[model samples]
Target: MSEMYKKEVPLYGDLIDLVSDVNTETLAQQPEIRQQLEHSGELTRLNMERHGAIRLGTAAELSMMRRLFAVMGMHPVGYYDLAPAGVPVHSTAFRAIETESLNRSPFRVFTSLLRLDLIADEQLRQEARAALDQRQIFTDNVIDLIERFEQQGGLTKDESQQFVKEALETFRWHDNTPVSKTLYQSLLAQHGLIADVVGFKGPHINHLTPRTLDIDTVQARMQGKGIAPKAIIEGPPKRDCPILLRQTSFKALEEAVSFQNAEGGYDTGHHSARFGEIEQRGVALTPKGRALYDKLLNQAREQLGGTPNEHNAAKYYQLLDSAFEAFPDDYQTLHDEGLAYFYYRAVDDGVDMSTAISDLDTSASQTETAKQAIADLIEQGAVRIDPIVYEDFLPVSAAGIFQSNLHDEKQSDYQGPSNQQEFEQALGAAVYDELALYQRLQSQSLELCLLALDSKA
Candidate 1:
């Protein structure tokens, strides 16, 4: 998908090259961070495309997409309701859950299902639904292979390659659109995102995001590389200890598109949707930590009183930094306060962590005690704490990216209630809880650390 996206969006290839250079430079300058990443199995995957975003028009398409990703070892994790942020869609990121799979290939897709219910015009809603139901996003060959894999449990090497080749076509961009210019404009007026989803033959990948060690640096240098970037980066303010994810993107490209007319010819039009993005991921925070982060972020945004566009970018950033002063800036403080999850490594041969975890009780009343014991283990040099990288999406950030890249004005009042139950039903499976996944990883790493410590002792 990354290769195909690079070919489809030339700017994406440039973004990839720029990220590679920035990552190499960042690692050279911050050897300590590089060492920690290497220890945590994050180093090898840094230079590859981390994720891509695609918007689907129907539940059937979404359900099939889930199965399609399963063949590649990616499962949906975390339900994100972007409606609250004025974007009329709900989404989940599909990626490998296990550490080994992620280390091998961290590629993921942020797939969103369009909410036809959000459209106010009943007539137009029916029309959009009809259009969506009329299209099939997958190829016949890929569908056959999916069934074959389901029956056989696995595909041969040749079959696997064939499946990949056939599947890539599902996301390939087509210049000829299915909908007429009239319906496309109507959808665009409702929400640019709606038009982008319903106007195309397939849900063409909108953006390909590359993980960067220094996103701020990349943002600063993007213009120098002849890439036009959005005014502000979306997410938490920059800090010594970055939390969650920070993302910035190059402006969406305006491409010549041909809309099919009733007379069998086409009318030339243009679309502004595809872009390139870069992300800097930090430690996954505990629920308590996330609550505090959300509070601070909202406070900052409330103070700004509007969207953080180019006009108010500077002031918004200042308010953001001021608000986040309450957040812990160092990893040690984050760990000790239970503000973030950590992957533990047994670092010393002489030190023993067995004593700390032997009576570890995870009951609510003993949770703090268990945490303190782990703290003690670390203080005694028995364990090294590596921050667990946050591997999920934020609803607000996702919506912000869509709004900025889709040529839509902010609709702060356009909020939709979260319908995770409906979304899961359409998904054909329940989405994984992101926080629980991080907690499990932390616990698993601690268990390994305990075993290593016991063997040494």
Candidate 2:
């Protein structure tokens, strides 16, 4: 890491201030919300291409990333270990939040720091590890500044100007310094965006996941094309409510590449590691509701015996839907239930809902009114269920994918016991005590996916 990059760049937390500090609440309610989302997505794609390598390497690049992302109101959230599957990988996933939802939940970026040791030569690997060990990734000043800015939200005019300037600089690459090919290779892999980062010169987009209303259909269509996925998109099986998220990735297509060797010569060949990813998402359910949803999925699965496939996805969804058709508690009745998680106020005026119920078309007795309403809302845009982000690669699923793709899965032995508690404490996150949360996320996510399938009985 160079001193110029170090002393000059602002951290991500500070950049978050620059974004959140803007008086943008009014803008969120308008169509601007969608525009902002599109803008943010575009920016992310750009970063994945432009700063693909160094963003994960030196302290400077890491700090710069924080600043750059903060400008878009994105924050770091969960730590996902893609390595549990045993492939050469290191990455974390995040949900980038828009300006409006800051109070509702943390908008996150699933930033990943790839491990260089996996690819470097023995001597280079030792040095890289040692550098990583000694390096201070985040300064106390940076953390303090972020915390203060978060609490205060907006700064004075002068501070805002300075913040914006500093934030932009974080993404700026180091002054075209010539680095060893090996070091550059390590830096490239650090972002974990695409396979080309690992010494290949050919660059391509990894996956551009769309939030679909019909994941089951999409999955079926793709699979029918003989596109075997990296894994079963996770979350729950299709159910009454939309599950949180589902994801699938197609295999990478080969692309031409050239690598510079240790002898300062070029080696040319073709490499492939970039693939298209797609996702479907549903409403973010409450934790308790998520639990019951999980149980319902297990119940549905048990009833179905052993096999699960796309054809039976809707059948299983209907089973869960029938079981939990009504509200769990009485206060919120079917008519009163609007969009599940999203908050909305009636835009139409002079119409008392209860008395004027007959004005709107109602489903017949055989058709459950709530179900019809849900279906209608889904079709008409009142309700929003995102396609599963599929950003998360389950350890088991990742391992499976790696095993399927690799020459061997059993080549390396990991015999050392893991101290999960110590690991959590070190990261300053809460200890994982309950399987309930994980199960619920999975279940609700599945239900959302099921709703997307129109074939539900």
Candidate 3:
């Protein structure tokens, strides 16, 4: 798919080249970071990691998409409602849940369901609904493959390759619109994003993001490399100990589009859809830590009086940095304060870790005494820890990127509360809680470390 996107968007190819160069330099300059990534098995996947995004126009589309992603070992994790942020959609990221699978192929997709309820114009809403109802996003071959995999528990290698070929058709861009030029303009007038979802044959992948080790460097160098970046990077400001995710993207492409006309012909038009994105992921935070992050972010935005944009980007970045100062800036502080998750391991050259543990139960890590015992192990240089890599998306950051790329003006008009139940119903399953997934991985690492140490002792 990366190759497909690169061919479709030449700038994406340049973006990939630029990111690779930046990663090599970053890994070379920061051996400690490289070593930490290697320990957590993130280094191997760093260069290959990519996440793409698509917006669905209906419940049926979203439900089938869940099934489609399942065939690739990706499941929805974390519900994200963007309506409150002004974009009329609720979303979930489809990705592999386990550590081993992520190390093997960290490709994920952020899929969103368009909220027709948020369209205040009832007539336009009904029209959009009718248009969406008439379109089919998946090929018949892909549906058969999905059912085959579900019924048989797996596909043969040949069948799997065929499945991928069929699935890719869903994400491939089509510049031809089913709606008339007038209808497309009406939807566009309501919201550019609404036009995007309602105007397409399928939820074409608008952007694909490659993982980066140093986003700040990439952001700095994008202009030098002839790419105009988004006005501001989204998410938390750069930190010594980064948490969650930071993302920036080059401007979306404006491509020629043809809309159906009144006489069963086509009318020429233009639309901006595809873009290239880059990300730098950090530790997944616990609920408490996320609250702090939310609070600080809200404080900065409220102070700015509006969403950060080109006019306010500099102030916003400074405000974001200053606000996060209250949060810890180092791993030890983050771990001690329960501000971030980490995977623990016995340092092979350090000590006899068996002597540092009185209990081997993985759940014991939650108890006060067990926590103190693990602290002792770390203090004695018997065990070392690495931050658990965050494998999910943030709502605010996601919304910001969407609006920026869609050229959708940010508005606080959509005040509807989050309806995760509705989203899950449309999805045909409940999304996994990302924090629990991270915590489970952390505990599993502790359990394995204990077993390895006891055997050594």
Candidate 4:
């Protein structure tokens, strides 16, 4: 997929090189961070970290997408409503869920289904649906492979390679438009995003994001590398300990495309939707922490009177920083306050534990004494805790990225309602709660650490 994207968007190759250089420099400058990543088994996956985004036009496409991704060990986690943010889509990220599966290959794809119901014009909505119904995004071979895998429970080596080849065609960009130029223009007039979904042959992989250690540095260096970046970074302001996800991207490319003409020839025009994106992930926030984050974010936006843009970006960031100051910045404090999730591990020193047996008071119950000893060991740095990387997307941030990449004056006042039930009904399965998954990981780690500490006592 990267090779296909690099071929279509030449600048994507440069973006990959820039991210690689940035990662190398970051590791060199911050050896402690590198060590932490190594201990957490995340360092090995850093270089391979890549996530792609695609937009689907129908429920059938989305359901088949789920089956296709299962072949690669990816599952849908989290539900994101982009309608509230003014984009006409709801989404889920498909990727490996287990820790070991994630460590092995952390490839993810942010998939969204276009909501044709958001179109206010009744005639335009019919035309859009007609255009979408005429198209088939997946190849026949890929569908057969998906069905075979489901029945057999696994794909053979030959089948896997063939499946990959067939699946890649679904995401490949097609320059020719299925709808006529007049219909395309009508859809574009309603919403640029509508045209993007209804005008194309397939939902081409729009943007492929590479993980970065420092997004600010990458944003600062984009211009020097001849890449034009978006004005403001999306998500929280800079912090000692980052929370959720921070994202930045280069502007979408304006590619020349050919449209079907009534005269049996092709009409030449251009489309701007695909772009290059970068991300910096932080610890997954618990429900309490996420509520606090949402509260502070809304407060900042309300004070600014709008979203962050070039005119008021500085002031907006200042208010954001001040508002978030109430949130804890240290890992230990965040864990103790039950604000964030973390993976805990027991650290053993060379010293004999028998020498410290007398340190525990024998008068108290065994459970109480063991708990106190574990607390002391944690406080004394005998147990280590690492933040669990946030493996989900923020709806507001996703919309911000979408708005920035879209053509200017493409804003839509979508006052439609969010129908997650409809989305799930179309999805053929219920989406997993990301916060619950993080909580389980944190709880399991703490239980293991307590058991180890109790044995030592």
State which candidate has the highest lDDT. 3
lDDT of 1 by residue, 1-457 (tens): 8888888888888888999998999899999989989998988888764788999988889999999998998999999988878898999999999888888988889999999998988999998998888888899999999989989998999999999999999999998999999999998888889999999999898988899989999999999999999988999998888899999999899999999889999999998899898899999999989999999999999999988899999999999999999999999999888899888898875755566767565343127777777778878887799999888888888888899988774764555678999999999999999899998888888778777776776
| Whole-model lDDT values for every prediction | 0.88, 0.40, 0.90, 0.87
lDDT of 4 by residue, 1-457 (tens): 9999999999989998999999999999989879878977899999889999999999999999999999999999999989878788999999888788899988999999999988999999998999899999999999999999999999999999999999999999999998888998998887778899999999899999999999999999999999999988999888888899999999999988899888878899989999999999999999889999999999898998877787788899899999999989998888777788888787786434443344544333135665466456667766788999998899999999988898542346878778888998998999888888887777677667656654775
Query: What CA RMSD would you report for each candidate?
Result: 1.6, 13.6, 1.2, 3.3
Models 1 onward score TM values of 0.97, 0.45, 0.98, 0.94
Q: Return whichever of 2 and 4 wins on TM-score.
A: 4
Q: What are the per-residue Cα lDDT tens digits for candidate 3 across 354-443?
A: 656655466768888788888887788778889998999999898888888888746748867789999999999999999999889989
Per residue, candidate 2 scores C-alpha lDDT tens digits across 273-382 of 44444444444444455566566556765786633334565665566556555334321331234313332222223222331232223223114664565445444443
Which candidate model has the greater TM-score, 3 or 4? 3
User: Candidate 4 regions off by >4 Å?
Assistant: 350-374, 408-411, 454-457
Runs off by more than 4 Å, candidate 1: 352-366
The TM-score leader among the candidates is 3
Question: Which prediction has more favorable TM-score, 1 or 3?
Answer: 3
Off by over 4 Å in 3: none
Candidate 1 worst ten-residue window by lDDT: 357-366
lDDT of 2: 0.40
Model 3, 139: alpha-carbon shift in Å? Answer: 0.8
Better of 1 and 2 by TM-score: 1
